[model samples]
Target chain A: MAAARSDRAPRRPTISDVARRAGVSTGTVSRYLNGGHWVSAESSKLITRAIRETGYVANSTARQLRTGRSGTVAFVVDEAPARFFEDPNFEALVVAVGDALAARDRSMVLLLAGDAQSAARAETFLVTSGVDGAVTASAHPEHQLFERIQAAGIPLVNVGSPTGLEDRIAFVAADEREGARLMAEHLIAQGARRIAVIAGPAHSPGGTLRPDAFTAAVDASASEGAAPVVIGLRHGDYTVESGRAAARTLLAEHPEIDGIFAANDQMARGAIDALREDGRSVPEDVLVGGFDDSAFAGTEVPLLTTVRQDFGRIAEELVDALDKQIDAGVRTNVIVPVQLVVRDSTVRPGS
Target chain B: MAAARSDRAPRRPTISDVARRAGVSTGTVSRYLNGGHWVSAESSKLITRAIRETGYVANSTARQLRTGRSGTVAFVVDEAPARFFEDPNFEALVVAVGDALAARDRSMVLLLAGDAQSAARAETFLVTSGVDGAVTASAHPEHQLFERIQAAGIPLVNVGSPTGLEDRIAFVAADEREGARLMAEHLIAQGARRIAVIAGPAHSPGGTLRPDAFTAAVDASASEGAAPVVIGLRHGDYTVESGRAAARTLLAEHPEIDGIFAANDQMARGAIDALREDGRSVPEDVLVGGFDDSAFAGTEVPLLTTVRQDFGRIAEELVDALDKQIDAGVRTNVIVPVQLVVRDSTVRPGS
Candidate 1:
């Protein structure tokens, strides 16, 4: 079919050419391409043959413009671009989202809204880019990006708990409280007496919900007549360096700190580095745990024990919700499960 | 502008509606939208005004379909999806390419052609998806994907040296030979007597070019009266585990090896891990160097010494070449240089 068309036109075929070949109005071809919303089945067959003959693959994005669908969704993150690589947690979710979207035959465009300039640029682009919808990991307090997306009438799926925008936007999140509690129980089981926490930023859900849950778990254990453990909390920016800095401050204030739970793996590795600098042996002198068993989790010398979120399920759910939202115009919230993965950091030798 | 338009249209505007308002054929409106190609100045003004009034934000993709342009490009990586996160090098390049593409107001759709099914899907999608062009890091023996993209008449840009592809396919590459020589000389200066090389897969340009250059440099140094150095070579799949296995094999065969150079940072880090497993201290027992100063480079215990390719410049060059090829039908080749970074891995303490 392509070879036959090759001899007919030196340049690539256009919609007008496809329409002409099909002996129909350009609107018929355009409508046929855009989900065949108003086109007849007879016109649809003609248009389909026209496309095969003309080799019109750009029909997907182009026809969306002529009609209402855009055939693409934006996977947005409101953080510094480096966070995508630095944190490794994003990688798992992004790939899973990409794969899931690909399976659904939807193209994914990544949009970064870290700084004010990028936020403004992303705002303008989202309004004009003709994207079908967005899946955002934006925890920014202002809800500026969300408002822009909403105002543009794009369906949105948020990651983590809601921030009280409108009730209409959907969200998918992991059971963070359960994850944190599991890690705390494991630490207490390992005979940790003085526990220090390296939490993520205060504004983020993981920053607050995780540590709050761990504290509650510890209090519950104390209520059951278990021996009391000294617990202190400090905040980090979810980076390894930030983890190291937070650990330094924790050690300064609580010299007897024997166990640490970092909000994420990068920070957990940082905490371990600080302990090693102070000549402390992991699982011997101190027990440490991290959240998000990322690619960097196992590389830590002690092979970090961490909470593993079901990113695969989260990605699938996010895509599923958005797909349904686009078709059914319904909003839903979903919470995926988490598991505790034990390794050298939290498990004592020969125990 | 958005405020007034929002009140006017509950449904997204279509090209036919814009054409009706502009008092012109849908073809005329589309031609104007594409690039104002054959549309007269008066018609272009009319179509532009109608699009604004109707809130036709999907004009970009739609107009491109009516015409012959896709307005999108494929960034092709023929590797497993895991490689994107596992090997930090791809992250840097992918980001750089994405940023460069975004700056030009173009969308980049990533295509993975690692396995047979994915490669077939990617091939069919590229030919039928109407992407304007593609920048490929493919070194697969078949060149099957390249042939498909070319037959589809999309512009192509290759990364690294060519492998007998058509002259029309542009390429942007880092000088692997010079990078290898610099690393080899640095190791010789560190007074290394026995060196083993961990090369990437033999089919790849990096796999062959880097090791060949390093061997040539070592031989040239030996002729210039440098101490005799025994060099052993083994191949890996540009992975950490593969590098570890390669290093183990090299060590067992040549136990006197005092220095090692892996083609990339991931492998170099793996070699260090192997040396440590044998109770050999980095820089004291074996000096090590790596290529591609990826994010993983600095994370190694001894802070890897590596050759830094100008990924930023390479990305820029690749985009520039493709842009020109898409416009002027000219293909070009660009070779970016590299620099060596000295870190703890190669430098002995207190030297």
Candidate 2:
């Protein structure tokens, strides 16, 4: 189609030229390009054909100016360069978000929120940088800049819910409770009586969700007078170091614990490290499971059993929802699903 | 200085309002603001005072159009997300480049040369997307695109030298040969008699330089009849997995080796894992060093002793060079220095 149009114009025809040729406004052409509006099918066909015929390349800057949009989305993550690299979810989430943004011809700007100064700077950019929307990973509940973003009228999407913001703002996150329940059920089915969990920071939304849900699931599954032992809960900052520290504490507190669940992959890797240091054979001595089916899950020596949250799919939905709001002034609430990924970490002996 | 001139129009003001009040043309005002390029210094000072009085913000885009120059620079890197995140040199380089660009009131656009398709698309944008100049990484050599950029009159600055393109292009890079020599000398000083090397992919320019220089340095250090045994050389793709696989093979083939040098940090990490898996304690049985003092180097149990390339400083120089070319039409070469970061990995027992 583009080739056929190439012969008619020396240069690519622009949307404004098409609008002039079709006797329609530039906004109408823009509406046609960003689908899901009220444009008639015939009008849509005409616009698409015109775009093909002229090989029209949308002037992103002009379109942004006319619509008071930047055609850009910003994403912020809690960052320590080392932690960011080691976290398997970080790579997956960024790739997913980048892919989603590229599909909509929108660029994704990354903001690494680490210190107070950088956070404030990122907030200023988020509000004033002309981005249409934002996606943030609220690792800590008390992040000040995220609050500023919430108040700035930009459509903010959360990869995981932030404390205090969940009730006031819309978010798209994994079903943490269901995923935890699956982990608990798997342990019970494998005849593991004593279960311990290495959780993330106590205040984080995700950290709180998995442990509480797992505890409740365990409580409900036990028969009268034969309840399974809840060994211990240890906290980590979703880093290998913190994970390793938590694992040592958990092991010391409950040496009889037969099953372990870590909230993320880095922590899970730390757990593996601790187990090795303590001379405990994986799956034979203790079954382990982790959250976030990151890229390294399959690559681990004893492959990590994890909860899979399709970050790319969620990212695509987030962009679609934001684009809808930008183009048609519509709003949406989306909930992404999570699934348990069983691997070498969770399998019992002889199973 | 900005507050000195208020409410009064000095001979030639910095802005149009100032120019109007001072009874001068806007062109004269612009020339004055551009540091008396075509105006007297007296006129420039008067214009500055007028600008101070009016509190005028320079419209960079408008100024760019008027001057037929874009206040923007392009930074091109390989599209590998893992490399982008894990390579400390790349991160430091970008931050430094950003600082330099910001200092000149310009913005840096990140261009990804991921694959042939994306590379082609990015090349099209880099040449025609209003960027003033470009800083390209030689690691991902796209010679054809480099030639096209040169033809487009875009001042090109390369990070490293590549085949067929050296001497023609301006470049800023660390002294790879010197860094390799220092690393080899350090290993020799630590009394390592048998050294096995894990080299990066053979295709990259740095890969060839580092290994060749290290071998020469090692040869030079050896006295008559006391040359250290060159155990083995294995190649990796500068990835952690590749490093691990290569390390495993190197260890299997050369069990007597007392020293190891990885071409980069990612490969060094793999060697660490391989050595640990084989029950060889680092710094006691084997001494190891890596290139690129990346974040991973610090995160390890015993931090890696490696070559520290001042990527940020180099990036600053690259941007400064590009700006000089743009503002004064000066072209020059910049050579940044590299340092050896000593850590626990290369330290021998007792010594």
Candidate 3:
């Protein structure tokens, strides 16, 4: 099919051609492409039809120069290259965001600012690269690229609620605190008395909020006559290996712990592996729950009972929020809802 | 840290400021930014120092207008969005490519041209958006976007050996046939007579070359008295679900099949799951092997015995090739080597 099409390659149609075909000026065609706000409805219809008939593809670079809008958004990650690819959640979010942006005729330029030098480079790129805005999925609160982007006056939307810049920048994130609270409560309801939590890095929003909320929920549900509900706490870097190491520490420190809530599915899988190696059964010996119902969650030996963050919706909201910022200079904070998913990992076989 | 930096915002420096500071013309500054090939060494050093002192980040839109280079490369995916993310191989390649490009101070713009309409939009974007070049990871042989990109006189680097357009476009791919042959030989050496192959989509390069090579290897190793080696053949869509379905069909048709080779790690995982469900112990009742030793391969219960494609090196070679194309207008084809990793999945448990 590609070969057949290549046999008769015609010169690409331009905006002038579209204007000529539609019997309108090039300015009218340009106005229509930028956003037909000033153009009449009838003229817009004629231009649209002309574009279809002539296969006119507006030169975005020239349009960008004229309108000062690039129709491109940067998806920046401030983690190491390996970590960025290792996390399934990141992949899901990227794909979702890419799809959402593509639907709006916008391109997603990936920027990985792993270290201080890279951050500086990325900041420079963000400022000068003609990208209209940026959506950051970086977990590090200390990442200074955001400050530089803000200084450059680039509209921004963060995937997770950025810690220091929460109030300043637009963001779309899952309800991390509420989701963790529900998971803690669910574990309690499943008859777990001594529950432990494997938290993410303290610097990250999800890392801090999830553990804090879980601790609060567990403490609030404690009965006056009952023993303490919490047993141990361990911090992980939101990876399977870290989760395993944390789980090992938790088991060694507090053998009486009956439940574990991992910050994410990767950690939960790691914790499960640790438990299995230590001769403990899932849900039977210790109830294990995770966050982020990613693709791997369902395929686990004991399917993960996790908190589902709607990544697709979050991506749509991020693009929508970024679009609003670009068009109207509005900064909106959007927190998408989360859901609890019970699976074999948390529920006992007979129960 | 971000908060601290936001207190004192400095004005971003421009090319004119760099030129004034360096005591050079704006044209000299532009030449330095665009590779410094024609600039004097003394002038280049002064421009570099001036850029550092003034923190001048060239406005890429204006720079693009002057140089006809966008400083952005489109990473086009012709497959569905979900498949692009679900496969760990794709993630590894993307991360590697992104890192390589980042090292060269280039941004990777992701373009998902999944279906016909999306492909058309992507083609238009590529033609009109002023992207410097494109790197396609599309497996589809008939993807029209490649032809459009070619017609637009844009440099392209395909991740895999795209069928039909292999000679026209530059590509960096693993030696798929050699890798498959090695896996086939490994399985045969493990005393597996009744081997079965779960192939990828027939249209893809890996889909055709891998199975063909495996068949050739098995046939070459066949003895005069030997009846038949391959007892069953099933095609998969390079996905876990497809692998599981295909494995079921293969098992049901040839219950005596003692070996299974899946085209990729995801499908190998699904094949393992299917074998476990059917009460077939790996390497004991039925040996299983996979290609692309991805992140999931190592984490599997019986660590996968697979063919490892060095995606990092492939990515480096891709960027290197693309860089050459951008600078010297040279198109090069790179075929990286693959290795067979032996693990418990293919070898007997005691062995």
Candidate 4:
């Protein structure tokens, strides 16, 4: 059989045909076409090849003109550059989102909104850099960034719960509270009593919600006549150094804590390092749990026990929501479920 | 003095005025404007704010037409995505290149040219992606990718030696041979006699040039009546795992090896890990030196001693070369010097 020979007619290939070529669900294809978020790499590659082979075009120039849309989606990261590069979680998401967008045949312009100047530049980039819509991540809740972006008449999608614009804007998030609760329960079941919580930034969703759920879980367990209780709570900026510092501080202040729940994996790793320096063993001495099972979690010497956010599903939902909003002037809010991955960090040695 | 309020006449500010405001050399500003590299972050931020405050524009739309520019540059990386993310060197270049470009008020569109399909896509991106010029990094020499881009009449400035069509193209390279020479001298001076070379992919500029230069240095040092000798050679895929695997094989084959010269930092780290597992002490039992003095080099436990490639200078030269070629049809080839950074890895512990 000939490997390549498909030039039947000059007519354009419809998205449905492209979807058939990719062998993915039509809904997935729609998500891909609209906001470039949820499409898997394999399907995207196949769809891309199929489109190239068939010369698929989304619409005529006239329709594009009528829509007044540019073929660009702004990938807005509202965290400082250091945080952007320091956390593997952000890099993983960036790669995932970029791939998803590429599959949809839409170009993405990355904009950093970390400081006032950078934020202003990002706003300028959105308005003057031909960006039609934006997908924001880790924006400060008090900054009114999303409101400003929406006010610019551009569609927006937030990675987590929108800062304060939930009713009008769209968002996609993992179940952070449930993830935290599961982690607490896992530690309790593993015989952890005096637990410590290393939380994220105070106003950020993970910082506030994850710690709240963890505390509630501890209180509920104690109410049910369980032995475990929250002994201390310290905050970290979702960084390894912050986690390490917080752990050192907790160890200095509350040495009786038997379990540590870090809001993110970086902090958990940091806490583990702090424990080792202080001549303590993980799980055996103080059980540790973290959230956001990042790329490097499994690579660690003692593999991390963490809450897993299915980035693929999040990307899919984010793309779908953005696509629907951009195309039909609608808003959607969806929370993908999270899972607890038990690894070396939580399990007792030799168990 | 007032911190704000500068609303002068509607006429656009000039580059000279912007340069003067930033207190940087005129050459630096010109280099920045032509292609987005070489300008340091501190100066770029100042220049950007100055331009913003003054509402500067390069020229009229009619002049822009005469120049046939899109204000967009294609930052082409001719490697697989995994390779792109794995090596810290690539990311450093990306951030540096992006910063360099942004300072000049030019946008960069990233394109990958790893496989045949991606190569085709890159070519298409150069022609159809509104790319005015290209700055290619780590492209395979045999691919004739530069030829195709030049044939497409798009101006280009390569990050290293261009594939085959060298005479017509512009390029900027770190002094690879000199860098290798210095590292070899450093290792030899540290009392290493039996050295093993963990090389990169053979055809890459670093893979070929660094090994050749290192071997030459070893031979030249011998001619100068030195004691160091080449013990073995192994190739790695510029990954930590590859370096570890190569080191394992080298140790099995040549047990007498006393020094390691990995072509890159990733492989160097891998070799270090392999050494630890083999119950060998670094510097005391075996000395190691790496190249690229990557962002993580100082962060490593032993603090890697390696050849430092000035990414900022490379970025600047690359931009200048491309700008010259694109603006005046001139071809430039310049080699910026590299440096040897001594650290914990090579130094004797007691010393």
What are the per-residue Cα lDDT tens digits for candidate 2 across A72-134? Answer: 566777564345555767777877887776655545656665544345445434432335677
Clashing residue pairs in candidate 2 are: B13-B47, B14-B47
lDDT of 2 at A103: 59
Best by TM-score: 3
Q: In candidate 2, how many Å is residue A303 off?
A: 3.9
Best DockQ goes to which candidate?
1
lDDT of 2 at B222: 59
TM-score of 4: 0.74
lDDT of 4 by residue, B244-334 (tens): 9999999999989899999999999999999999999887799999999998889978889999999988988877777787677788899
What's model 4's interface RMSD, roughly to a tenth of an angstrom? 15.3
Model 1 lDDT per residue over B319-338, tens place: 99987777677889888999
TM-scores, each model vs. reference: 0.73, 0.65, 0.76, 0.74
lDDT of candidate 1 at residue B327, scale 0 to 100:
67
lDDT for B344 (candidate 3): 87
Worst 10 residues of 2 chain B by lDDT: B5-14
List, residue by residue over A75-171, the lDDT tens digit for candidate 4.
7887755467677877777667756765665555455556544554454344322345788898885555675566445679988876456687788
Give model 1's DockQ, 2 decimals: 0.18
| Model 1 lDDT at residue B52 | 45
lDDT of 2: 0.68
Better model by DockQ: candidate 1 vs candidate 4 = 1
Models sorted by lDDT, best on top: 3, 1, 4, 2
